[model samples]
Target: MIHTDVTEPQDFLVALGGNMPSEAGAPGDTLQAALAALAEAGADIRAVSAFYATPCFPAGAGPDYVNAAARIGAAMTPEAFLALLHRIEARFGRERVRRWGQRTLDLDLVACGDAVLPDADTFAAWRDLDPAAQMERAPETLVLPHPRLQDRAFVLVPLNDVAPEWRHPVLGRTVSEMLDALPAKSRAEVLRLP
Candidate 1:
């Protein structure tokens, strides 16, 4: 059910990451293959940031991850687009066994145009959620602009390459601002892969 003809073709920001290797090859190779899959499956990928090598989130979830970001455009709704991302993850052997666990691939729908998904209050609830709570609970529904997008250096450092000027609909901060907001050490940990 890919949206071929539609009235709303929204801009999309996607965060890509993986620590575990898939059948495609190494984590970086898998990410490259996944981007190709997105294009073949109908995403109008506009730009992709450089790959980064980041320490495993949670300190010891697994090995380090290869992370990147992509700005794309598609005619599908956010929900439909998320489903497509999940399907692509599945193809890469992604498993949802636990939150923040190591994975073969992760294709997160970071934002959809300026849309505040579900609603402002609901988005705020997750957006303002604490890190401890974030590890213990996962939202049952999608939140636009991704609640934790502004907080993760690994996410923003790579995202800077593709969309530094893209502003957060709720936070009123650009990607560059968020990246700068992160502690210097946090940003330093996300080293660009040559």
Candidate 2:
């Protein structure tokens, strides 16, 4: 039997973080507004983690950031979903002017089910990127499971709330496992807001 509909609706993981304020007023507000935008843009949001207050990347690039994670079921291709996210970010005045720069909004496509975007080898290349190279380089294409998710307490801590059981398609580690693996000081940094 030819399986014409082999693909299931995938729940995509999204990681939202921002340090700068937009017209929305504050970093947390921007994250809330972005979630609403995602819902309006055809994403069937299944879950959202509580807002988190985390220090900015690179120590002092800007103010501390608000972070959160969401799981949404979307039927579109990953690229299209990413475009939608970028459009929403642009709507909030996000600019691609700098890598990991302070932004009004940042929506990252963290993962989608068990799919290894681009490919495993490429993903591995990014996953194993050196710290200096990571600071200086950004991938030209989408990388599935977000190459750095495993090591980021800011991302994994929020993700633990929404998808603690979700396993890495390549690494086979669950969100909670990854979160637990981080240093105590690192995990302690992601403080959830009321």
lDDT of 1 by residue, 1-194 (tens): 36655576779999999999899999999999999998898788899999999999899779999999999888988888898999999999999999999999999999988889889999999988898999889888888979989989989998999999999999999999999999999999999999
Q: List the residue pairs that clash in candidate 1.
A: none
Deviation in angstroms for 32 in model 1? Answer: 0.7
Q: Which candidate number maximizes lDDT?
A: 1
Query: What TM-score does candidate 1 reach?
Result: 0.96
Best by TM-score: 1
TM-score of each model, in listed order: 0.96, 0.94
